[model samples]
Target: MNIYKIFLLISLLFNTLVLQAKEEKISIQLDWLHQFQFAGYYIAKEKGYFKEENLDVIIKEFDFDVDLVNGVLNSKASYAVGKSSLIIDRLEGKKVVLLAAIYQNSPMVLISLNNSNIKKIKDLKDKKVMLTPDARSAAAINSMIISQGLNLKDINFQQHSFKLEDLISGKTDAMGCYLSNEPYILDSKNIEFKIHNPSEYGFEFYGGLFFTSQEELRQNPIRVRKMHRAVLKGWKYAFENIDETVKIIYEKYNTQNKSLEALKYEAKILKELAQFEEGNLGNIDYKKVEEIKRLYLLLGLSDSAINFKLEDIIYNPKKINLTQEEKKYIRNYQINLISNSNFPPFTIETDNKLSGIEIDYWNLVRKKLNLISAIEVINNNQEANEKINTNANNLKYAFGTADYENINSNMSMSVDKVKLALTTLVDKPYTTAITELANKKIAITKYASYYKDLKKKYPKINFVETASINESFDLLQENKVYGILGKLPALSYNITKKTISNAKISGIYNENYELRLHVNKENRVLLNILNKAISTITDEERKLIRDKYNSIIYEPEKDYSWVYKIITFLSVLIIIVVINNRKLNKEIKKRKLAEEELNKIAHIDGLTNAFSRRKIESILELELNREKRYNRGLSLIFFDVDNFKLINDQLGHSTGDNVLEKISSLVNNTMRKTDSFGRWGGEEFIIILPETNKVQAKNIAYLLKEKIANFDFEIDRKVTCSFGVSQFEETDCADSLLTRADNAMYYVKRNGKNEVKVV
Candidate 1:
């Protein structure tokens, strides 16, 4: 061999090395600049997780509407951090599909000063709130406002610059903030703040998702999956050893004052914030994606959108290997059939078939269990419910009806309340001035829990009973009754042009009812699956599905121009008539003014112009109604100023009011719209929180207590509130609820004022 042969061999080996390096270069674009929020990607890079996967990954920072999704679609990048809004973007024909969600819950929140007297999402109504012009925060706030029965136009918005200045200066009641960022700033500034996280209130959407083009998902799914696994490993490492990851981030960015301690704290927060349970880190909930899509549609954010089904968006968890015996057990188990009606939508009928959410859910359960049999649907609620009760041997496993009360004795049943919009209206003549119909019969399904209150409220009126909601609507149209109560969607469907057109909806009843699947005593296996399925279907998913098809039928506006002109003409013609009605008009105006004053007083805190004790009580009552009616859960917290007498003694009487007013304002500012804050007594306050359990309530209470203790009251005086929380129980009376909360508060008092106690 000569020198020329050695040179040729060396050149070939060098070329092969270059080709392998080219294949390994992978660039990923993130949705935003680097932070703990993107720690997983950073950790993966730093810890050699990506390197182990034989990948050289470059993570690019996205800025100023730079669509990384478009980069993926165009093959410029392999993957990117996709915002929850990416679902909306995809629906609108963008070529990106979410691969995984970094956060299980959305981190976007509405933050307010510790003294703005604005708490909860509902409090933003008719109030000024600051918003970022182009973020998911705006969409979330809008959706929240709409859900509270208020329109976007009802509230005023100031443009926010991602700072706490507007809130600090009291220019805006609340400012949009991320739970991981702005809250830390507020804490560092020693400024107390309240945060309203939309995710907690059913405004469900994914955040910080890993996304790629559908084409990429199809072409290189294995590579995509490998990336996901590595990303997850990185997240686990970062979560477990946050200090090291924070140091890496600080060193990489040359952030000298990054405060590794704060970064570690933020990491711990992110661990809870990110989706760590369902799959590894960065797994997107398909159901949540579908919900976000529906929200986008409702918000009118997209046009000519493709319908993305739940199956299309979610990344299914990796398949787990199972033994043959386990597979057989899953395959052979028979799900009981309970309900009868076979109602379309809830229970679809196609080619004499039956399928819907219930069917789909049960099927998923069977698939998960490796079961082969299908869940059977019965014809009527009575037959199914009755059969299950009467003969244990008839069908040990049956899916039937169960109300809140049905969960009592005699029969063992698992109840899942499906939230739906329901409304009712009396005939025009009857609604206006018909006395005879005041006592006339109104129809509702007999076993339905919604009827219990209506019947109790109007005991004197004749109650018309029906077997099903459809029959009740029919009876109303046939003049057999004065009013009909039914689900809002079904009622709206019946009054559509293709259906009955003569009927008109005049009134809406705010009743949230549970539609449950009752199981017989002997069928524990089927009941367990049913319970699991219900728990899996989150409140946000239910709301999204309900709002998706429940079309809003706007009534044609009345053309009152001619009528106004005629009335004006008549007014001129009948000067004497006008003179005679002057006193009446004055009285009416006075009454209107009085009513306005009363309404204001009802909502305002009498001692501090925040919210009154009555207002908080009313809110708690309403929340209780909503919880029971919807079969959801909530927490009520009672808080009292610890050693309030000390403050009064040190600062005089007027100073006490000022202190009270300051604390009252702080409490009001700290609560979410879903939370109601009111002064319960001289120095005691109550917070009524909807859709919150004891644990969340405790966390919120702790934060509040800490804020109150650290807050500056302008006079160098310090104050703190002791919190006592009680979760709403099924059969709990209002007094019992108060007593339990009082007990918890006393326990908090004994422990120390600046503490949270839960009952």
Candidate 2:
């Protein structure tokens, strides 16, 4: 080798050694087995972001025996990834800094079958519930029950089996499931289920939090920042390129055996949950942390958690400012904000103009953030629910999204600022105790917060649902319902206008009336700006806004003009009624005469009215019953027109019918008042004798046959019938007697036309 080339090779070799030496080794303790829940980390490793940052990061699954907090604290794991609130850890002196949030919206949800009546978190009392062993998820569950004035002791807790079979097999009534996990299994199988999200009821918590001990941040800040940067980059890539990331995960890092499709779905859901698509990739908001802590403290209110502030849980805080790219993305971009049209103070619409405390507050927030906004008012709870379900930020700030956006995956920042009360008639006043609501039919708006959840919580109350609070108020006024459940503004507004002086605001449910701002997971770039704007809201400003709306009196104009108008209308109605009565009397008289004629027509057969078949049968049955009781003789002479089928087929039914009519007239002429005669059916007739022997009936039948045979029928020239005389038998019933008479008639027809046969 030449001297210059050797020097260049030696320098290149040294540089390569130095680059290799610079790579730092770190291990992240993930909460569960390998899955797309950790897709960002997997993507970072696979896509070489960690390598780019000179990191030789080792990803480890959490062992069942591992203490999650101690793992990082004791250096068993350099960092830990978990889905929980870290308030407990910070209070316990673990001194962990939350580096970045993996999922902005927690994927944890309490899931039940579609048919299950359990609708809300409060409904979980006395029901079987399965929870993950993790403290964070369990703690949230406990907090929920506590919020409902119940304890964890009231619930039947089942240990999670880490498989959906426990839930599918009915071992658990409700199971804590990840939106990215068990729900996907149900969805893939097209099984319907209901997801009970805590955030929906104002118990908002975080999910997939990435953190390390404060010592890690203090000693190796560069490496910590690198790790945070790399993980966030991985999440961004995983969310944006979902398909490609799923391929990388499934083909390489999959230990949970999650299908590529499932991973893809998980990625799509995480984008909304983590707000990666919403441009909130790994951006930590300390205000959200504070909100979580405040809620937890309120739920448990333990002394340890009380000492911890929002900053204690977050490592290094970044100021609320957007980059040029962020500014350009949001500038002049009017946020599609949704609110309630009828909800007062927080949200109200007057003459199509939406102005309320919430609106005023959000407007101020918008001005601070330098963004324009368009407000959408949800008219009812249904609209409120559906409005927020979008991936877009709703005023409730909870979002519903498209199918591909993944349900239960939207970042939520709860503004826990409202309350609700139950109103009842003053005569039927109720106490606030849930138990006291037993046997009462409480009228609630169908669109009430956590409506299904309310159903689950208070199974005792028979809920009469109304579309609006006004409808519930009407129901309450009529004494049709025992009580009404609504916000203070709604209840107060409704009761004051119902001038009957019968209704009063009664019991109040201490539920979290927190309003939330829901941003689409795909459009979370403006969340920080919004949060910064929210932070500027003074306590005085909040009180001022609320007080103004609360004190506004809605005095319904009680003009008695309506009463005078009603009296005038009633007088006119009475005059019309009097004239109608006279006309009705005359109509009634005419109707009675027409009814008499109708009765006569009904009994007489139109074609051949020889007492009618129905009348003859009535006479025969009465005579037979009398014969059985008194031992009196009774006889029936049944006959059919000889060769009737041949006559109809050869001569046409019109001619056949004309011949039968002539025969019936001849038989009627010969009948006695003591006897009854009628057409049995087409081409057939029957005679009933009240007190006659078989021989006597035979003679009568022969006479009738002879008359029919000689009678002229216009079309057939002559008409005759074969006769069968049958006496009532001791054992004969209606059907048996008819059969015997029919057999004798057949015999007569077999012998010859116009002949008599007795049986």
Candidate 3:
């Protein structure tokens, strides 16, 4: 206890106290009751990873009333574990920010027994389905059901009791269960069951996401990034050493009283969901998140029409991993930017300056990569290719031209995919199905890279060549071609414009359009620089650029002087003819007006714009004769709006009329061009499905039911329809066929509405 020794002891004690006081305390809310699902948080705390980052972490287990999102938003917790529904929450104006996606694919699925006979999603239709109240509106479960051609309103949904015995006791035919927890229990009991995963139906979603409020991220970004890093590290360690993690969880964090073997099984399945074998832990793909957002919109889960920026939703604190040589290349070398001027919505030459999405992206890339460049507008891809091949003007690094396939062996392309779409007029006898394009005329721009390949693949297709997309559209408008094939972005751009009315995107081109940044392979550093630049450009920026240019009307400059001169000549000639035969002209005009009015009244329904009853009868007669002569399958779907009179009484007749018009428009847009849709009478419609049988027609009816049930009508009213399907028999005439369809429809109406019945 000498004076000097006592002072040294006091100094060490003071430093220790300071270190302890500086450690920041934070808590994370789990999404469900404590189990191995939150094992990463437990491991991070146990292994002192959070402590190493100067974080004092508290793990909050979920309860029946715990709101995971609100817990974080209201500052009750610093972070939270959530599922894909966070996407809908964010779109609905929640300030939640995602830090990491622990599970690549969600474990949420509908489970049933082998003996329950609920094998497919449609089988659960009228069966007692149990779901947790929280999961009733979950994006993964609901989207799968809707995507499988079943309406949510049609299913018999029961509140989940969260007990496995209920399902075993035949109290519930199917239950929304977790693949990680419930499946392990059923397997232990040797229960033979079937899994209906949303992924199987193309509704894959991320699971076990770590998220925090934007306020926390904005106020303490460094701490947030450190916490994110530590959590990912903990996950990596947990998956690699599953036995040790399971032992730790069973000892300390097993709030659910899980057995050792059960925890081990959970960890095994979680490892697969984590996708750690790919060696990229906690990595989120922008494209995947964008798709989930779109699915939410499609499922009517998101209330707002505003688009959420994926960059804002996903957290990426790391900078571009560029090598020193690539960095130096970016600083020293100036890029030679070549663009195709005729590529609408991507590149366009206006006032000798190229403007479009490509230019906008280049500007952002330039600012991010810190590269100096100038854009050169080359109207033709052929000229751009020649310049790129020859390295004209001794250019060292050039990029941003569309035609990059096999142009030069020394050139390399960026790792981004682009696609083209087939578009056709909606009213014409053309469809989006590629198999039906045989012997049909399709217009495509000349010098397109896939033109030769398409011609070689489908020799029977007559691909009409045009100088540009504008010319192709001209051909389409004049009814000279069945459809037009062009860049997908261009087609999307035209849809918002009045340039092409009543046009629909039929299908995507089979061959991928190889449109990417082309750099000389010899310049590897430059190639790396370009790749890094493109990868770092966020989807939000791309969307903003697309929206800006897609709104622009990009009709090519045309000389209308010759057309005016022709009109003037015709006007003079018409004047002379009118003067010569005034009385005869008046009589001809009167007769023509009468004939036009009669044609419109006879052929088209005044309210819904569908074909009139007489016209539909004529069409049905023609289709029946065709089927008889050719011996092909033919079926009809007779349907009408359910509770039509009630809607008219409650919402007024105008609202009812609007519903009919919308239904007509929806059917007209979705059905195949060859299939004829017409208004049979008030609140009734018929579809003539040529070459389709009863089962196929019933499937179509189911699709219509799902669509109409989900469509958002005015006054927040849900609209549904009753459908009846019937196939023509060998001895059946047109009248007999109609009678059968009509009878089946009435049967559906008699029994509950909003269902399809086949006869």
Tens-digit lDDT track of model 2 for 56-133: 989987577887878888888999887555666676566888988777667788888866678656677898888756
Span of ten consecutive residues with least summed lDDT in model 3: 393-402
- Colliding pairs, model 3: none
Query: CA lDDT, every prediction?
Result: 0.65, 0.70, 0.76
The TM-scores, one per candidate, come to: 0.42, 0.40, 0.43
**Counted clashes in each candidate structure:** 21, 24, 0
Which is better, 1 or 3, measured by lDDT?
Answer: 3
Relative to the unseen true structure, what is the C-alpha lDDT of residue 618 in candidate 2, on a scale of 0 to 100?
78
lDDT of 1 by residue, 547-604 (tens): 5445545333344579889999988879988899999999999999999999988888
In model 2, what is the error at residue 63, expressed in angstroms? 2.8
Q: State which candidate has the highest TM-score.
A: 3
**lDDT score of residue 285 within candidate 2:** 75
Candidate 2: stretches off by over 4 Å: 1-16, 114-117, 135-140, 301-303, 306-309, 317-759
Residue 727, candidate 3: Cα error in Å is 21
174 in model 1: Cα distance from truth in Å? 2.5
Q: Residue 150: error of model 1 in Å?
A: 3.3
List candidate 3 segments past 4 Å from native.
1-21, 156-159, 319-759
Query: Best-fitting candidate, measured by lDDT?
Result: 3
Better of 2 and 3 by lDDT: 3
lDDT of 3 by residue, 1-759 (tens): 899889766754553353243678999888777777877888899999999768999998766677888888998888988888888888888889989989888887888998998867889888999986557777789887876678888888997777888887789998888788889999889998888887655456788889998888666665786688789878888888889999998888876788988888888888888888977567788867875776677667767867778878898764454566766766776678777666766766668766766677667767877777777767655577666667622122222222433345233233233455777776544344566788889898767766766777778888899987778877888889998876667776767554566676766655555345565445666655655556555546667765675443222224467989999999999999979999998999999999999999999999998889999999999999999999768999999999999999988999999999999987886576578888999899999988776765775687678778877886556899999899999999989999899999999999998999999
